[model samples]
Target: MRRTAISTTVLALTFLAVPATAQAQTQYTGTNAPIKVTLTVQGPDGLLFKGKVRTKGHDVTPATGGTHTCDGTNAGANPSPVPTPTAALDDAARVNGFTWDGTWYASFDDYLVESVKGVKSDATAYWNISVNGTSIPVGGCQFKLNAKDTVAFTWTTL
Candidate 1:
């Protein structure tokens, strides 16, 4: 009986001495933070349009709607804003070395389709854009315009 007690005490002590193999497990890494990119488009006027594009991995929130600050030169310029498109074409023309002149559509069908034809200063690419966001992808850049990138365009009414 004494030997049995001693062995039980030893086993208990051994078990107590052994550190608990399982502790609170925590996941402290491999988290992705959200990314935001702003794309501003201006025409003959100042601050034509501004958009905010945001994305996390494959999830993206394209531009839904925004106001356009029509210049005095534009007809019926009374803050007659329009619906913005979810995405715009980031087109580049080859003639002027990567000049961007792309076009963007609006969420509302009535709004005039924006036609952008300019040179992207940052990339030096000439582009010709139309209403729909359609263009050949270049520079391994996926044509995924997030919600943060505000896009705008202007044209003289014929």
Candidate 2:
């Protein structure tokens, strides 16, 4: 068999085996145990929150600035988000020993973490969320975390 053809077949099989994200359940099935992960919140001032946190849930308030475009343009009209488990970065960030704030963006169906500790996103800087040192296209609240995932919210600029 040709090398290119063999690789193509293998790649196709891998895609077929991987379940869709919306339908897939995590490895820890049927268990409500908190997803413990390392969380870091770095603002312009300095590191605000750094420690392990629980992704099970939190009593903190939901992001309240209506919505924002991917480019950080606020949508102006705040819509009350339906209560649900963001169950990802937002869930884990609820702890880490710092007060966090964010706003829900319907455009992405995720929460854009706006402020950490006392530092807030402004015309000059914003919170950039990364997992394992890589920036992802989706919002933190949408990105599922595995155990030991290094979730960092670093202050960034345009």
Candidate 3:
């Protein structure tokens, strides 16, 4: 009878301990943290620029929405922001010597697309930004990033 009592007590304690262990596992440990986002620049001809930049981990929260700030600019479309792609290029500038003249943003080492010309003028290719194959409403500065998000810049002709 005593042995049975001891076994019963151990079983009950084991059951109780299982819940605690499970709860600890569920708590966020920041694993798989977003270290960088993939940046792909493409043109009508073919792939132009391909690179990766470390994510700043700044304002990664989705709740911040349109409130995130970048280089003294706010989110939303007064002029339509391409924040994610722009931000990636900015990061690239610091890390990879990338340069931009208006819509043209690329690393000089590769000089893949040469210069992206014009904005609203006819017969000019413009740079378009997208994340995971979907265009974002905001620009790079305001665009929040998750771990390993893909940011793409495509040059399209008018």
lDDT of each: 0.27, 0.49, 0.44
- Mark the regions of model 1 whose C-alpha exceeds 4 Å error after superposition: 1-34, 56-158
List the lowest-lDDT window of 10 residues for candidate 2.
71-80
TM-score of 3: 0.48
Q: Residue 38 error for model 2, in Å?
A: 0.6
Best by lDDT: 2
lDDT per residue (tens digit) for residues 66-105 in model 1: 3332111112211222122222322211222223322212
Clashes of each: 29, 1, 8
- Tell me which of candidates 1 and 3 scores higher on lDDT: 3
Total colliding residue pairs, candidate 1: 29
Error of 3 at 76 (Å): 7.1
Off by over 4 Å in 3: 1-34, 57-73, 76-83, 103-123
Model 2 per-residue lDDT tens digits across residues 66-146: 432221111211122211123433454444344567655355444656666668776556677667797543434433456
How do the residues 19-84 of candidate 3 rate in per-residue lDDT, one tens digit apiece?
444334322323223357788767577775677787452322111123233321232222232224
